[model samples]
Target: MRADRLVSLVLLLRQHGRLSATALARELEVSTRTVLRDIEALSAAGVPVYAERGRHGGFELLPGFRTELTGLNPDEALALLVAGSRRGAQAFGLGSALASAMLKVVDALPESYRDTAAGAAERLLIDPETDLLSRRLVDEEVPDAIAAEVLRAVFAGHKLRIHYAAVDQTPMWRTVDPIGLVTIRDRGYLLATKSGADRTYRLSRILAAKELPEPAQRPDRVDLDRAWQERSTRFRTGGDQVTVLVRVNPGRREDLLGTALAVRAEEPDADGWLRMEVSFQDSRHAKWALWQLSMDAEALAPQWLRDFLRNRATAIATRYGVSS
Candidate 1:
């Protein structure tokens, strides 16, 4: 880590030409005393570093001394800089390291392109705080200590003991073989197995965690994308799911289909309506999703669902028709 710090320090000086001790300390996220010691180390190691005295003076590399690290074109440099702004790495407990790496990336660019690349990146936005719907994106916080433990087990191929709070269930301790960690939509999940059965746990719901000494019973190498796909498919198809036959206005066909899990069959009706057999996670999900389409979609089969909707509509009509 010290070696990494030393290399970053050299890159910093190379980029800026000169920086005060306080400035170097701030950029390196280390104490000024450490920066001074590293400067001494650099000079003693034959680097052409020299110091200047006075309030306006600071440390600088000897004139004409440049490290050969300018390989990126302006667009490539800007792309790297923009990607470095992502907060996803923070969820994996690499926030500080990501920041340091970004600094090095910017510093490595050619002097003529550095400022321009950085300025261009600043003008672009990724993952804005709020969308047009005025919904704010929130990042869940995982304590540094807990994240470190999770990452340690994941990388070291060890089993993990976690206190997980499943939805609608009491918190319980689980020992899982951590297959991998995945972050989606700013939330983190541990894709693991318990007794060789696939299980996924949200990092936010991990009330507590501990790493076990036993080696994890997972593959030597994992394809996370494939693993996620398989798990997602199983979850979608293997629940207490329901299938409904529904008639929807042809114009709202896409809207109805979008809410349903899948369309098993479709046919055009006499009045230009579309009859579809759709699947939903469950009856409640079916009712809720169909309710969103109001009169445009009607559940035609599963007598119970049709009766439920009829009763609901009747109650509403009854209420409106009552005399004052």
Candidate 2:
């Protein structure tokens, strides 16, 4: 492990030119004492490393000292190949570029690892379009022109203007300070700010986009993952959520949980079924999810929901000329 840490230390100094012990410790997730020991180890091992002392001083590697990428083991190489096989890059219009880079990665690998890594990657599948139930996964479509422009703005730190179509609303033009882009479950989103307020726009809903010349007024550094989580928490908690007590067959428990926002509590009933208190976004969401299970699930509480389901079922039966 220390060998890996020393290799990382050398690479970090090589890449960053110079880094303070505190900075190195932070990046390496170790203490300053550990960093000092690693630096001593590298120097003693014939690495041309030296230190500069001042308020802005740090450890630096001698110029012209570089390391090769041959240190990657078979497993690490395999992991990179498999991760690169994911289709997320396609959402950014970089599918072809990804393919080219992957070839280079495979070529750079040691001969001993090349065939094993490539064969392992070939055996793994990621994000197939259909599931075991033959249900198609939703892949939101974004025009290449629009995606490219949005990507440019986000990377360039420029304001962006877009013609966006919100749900049940007409398309309208708006300007936003581009923050970053996120892709989840094949759906792309633009995380930005409008008038100092956080805003997230689905990329598919962006009818058109333009990169503006003006610089964006955003923070120099951002934790996009934390920002997205906060927004998601707010959205989940702000909705007209409905909690339901339902009893479901054991075999269908996962199907019931798939659509639920949260499961408050669950226990096995004497009948060997699962009694779960589940939360949905609203009454409609609860109705739709429960309807999917048909006889396998039943709503136990909230007489209104039970009545609604009965009435709907009765109406359906009557339509087919059967007595309700």
Candidate 3:
């Protein structure tokens, strides 16, 4: 493990040119003392490592010193291959580049690992467009030109102007400071800031985009994952959410959960039926999801929901010429 740590330390220095012990420790998830020891070990191991003393000084490798350490074992190689098979890169218009990089990774792998990793990756499927019920997964379509312009702005840390269409609203032009891009369930979103206020725009709804020359005013570093999580939480809790107590067949538990915003509690009854307290966006959402389960699920609380379903079912039966 120390050998691995030393190798990582060297690579970090090589990639970053110089790193303070604190910075190295943070990146390695170890203490500053451990980073110092690793640096000493690398030096004793004939590595050309040196240090400079100043407020802005840290350890640096001598010029032109390189390590031939691939540092990847068979399992690591296999994991990379399998992850590369995902379609996420395609959303960014990098499908061909991903394929080329994967080829190079396989070629660089040890001969014994090369074939095995590739074969294992071939057997694993990810994010298929259809489910077992044969329901087609609808993917939002974004024009390549618009996506390219958005990507340029996000990566370049520039302002972006977009012609956007919001639901049931007129299309309008807006300028935003690009933060990052996120894709969920094949739907792409642009996280941005407008006049210092956070904004999220669906990529599919962007009719056009133009990258601005002005530099965006934003923090030097951003924790994008945290930002996205906070935004998602606000969106989920801000709406008129409805809580429903329902009894559902165990076989349809997943089907019910798929449409629920959150599940408060769940337990199995003596009859093996599942009783769950679930939250939906609103009464309409609850009704729509529960209705899909039909006889398999029953809403116990909220007499109004029961009445609504009963009336609907009765209407349907009467329409079919059956007595309700």
Candidate 4:
């Protein structure tokens, strides 16, 4: 596909806001004279074009400045607008700002792209629609701008003071120094340095980071990067690891361990029962396996393990219908 002329100009500007004649020419695959002429053309049109000559400097546009969509061909602009809408309404927040932003962009689009935009939108609908609509509103809902600022703060590596809601209490405002923003599964998380000897806060619980002064006491003890690694690994492997040697009927080997503790199935021995070693933790696992496996499991190593299985079985039998 041919590159849109509008997109080409923006790309050039993005790369060469302070670009040398030689550098811009190489980037655009054109002659140095052509690069000089384009710079003049942009400046004559008052496009905020500027350049500097030095070992470390070239062309650069000022930050936070955006060119008008008049630069983009109609079809390209409309396509972006429609695609953005499918992100779900609730996620768009208070003013339905996403839709409004799209309107501005679409208004800028030339007439030629209007029909194509409508046709494309009609054919494409957001499916399996899952988004912020599924959750109950908190203080962040009272003002949506907070959510935007919190995201910005996280990216900036700045401290945040947000009204944080607890699981079973009233929300309280807190100041946290952010370390890293992590995404576990689908949702985003701000891993930050918190007061009272903790250094992390969940973004969902934060109402907004309206203001932040400085860290109360940044932990010199814990390495946040290392802690993040350990936490992520534990999430996959369950809690503390323990090996369970289950003497099971040989043929049931694969199905037993695979369906049970979510461990790799092991090879069976000559005995009619195949001893499967699985990683687990505490007595809770022993109890869970005892009940689920029922007669199939007989703990082989560590006499305590076999005793655990038996004790759990007895407890279940005692607790069955004790309400009477």
Decide which is better by TM-score, 1 or 3: 1
Highest TM-score, which number? Answer: 1
lDDT of each: 0.88, 0.87, 0.84, 0.59
TM-score of each predicted structure versus truth: 0.73, 0.68, 0.65, 0.41
| Model 1 residue 185 CA deviation in Å | 2.9
Q: List runs of model 4 lying over 4 Å from the truth.
A: 1-75, 88-95, 127-145, 155-157, 166-174, 179-188, 193-200, 215-234, 237-324
Looking at model 2, the pairs that clash are: none
Clashes of each: 0, 0, 0, 9
- Provide the lDDT at 234 for model 3: 78
Task: After superposing candidate 1 on the true structure, give the runs of residues whose Cα lies further than 4 Å from its correct spot.
Answer: 1-68, 249-258, 301-324
Q: What TM-score, to 2 decimals, does candidate 2 have?
A: 0.68
Backbone clash pairs in model 2 (N, Cα, C under 3 Å; residues 3+ apart or in different chains), count: 0
lDDT tens string, model 4, 1-324?
113322354455653355667766775567877666776776776767677768976666675445345567656765676566553333313234555455556544544665567567766655333446875322223345765776556555567778888656799987776655554432455566665443555556777566454433444455657778766565447655556766777655655655454455566667656766676655566556545766766777667877777786788889994986
Q: Candidate 4: TM-score?
A: 0.41
Superposition TM-score, candidate 1 onto the true structure: 0.73
Query: What is candidate 3's lDDT per residue for 1-324, written digit by digit as tens?
Result: 677567667767765788899999997789999998888887888999999889999999997776332678878988888878777766665565576566556656666676787788888888887899999877677777888899999999999999999876999999999999887777788999999999999998999999999999888788889999999987777678888999999889999989998999998977889989989988888889989999999999789889999999999888999655
- Residue-wise lDDT of candidate 1 within 43-121, one digit each (tens)? 9999989999898888998876764357788988888889888888777777888888888777766678888999999
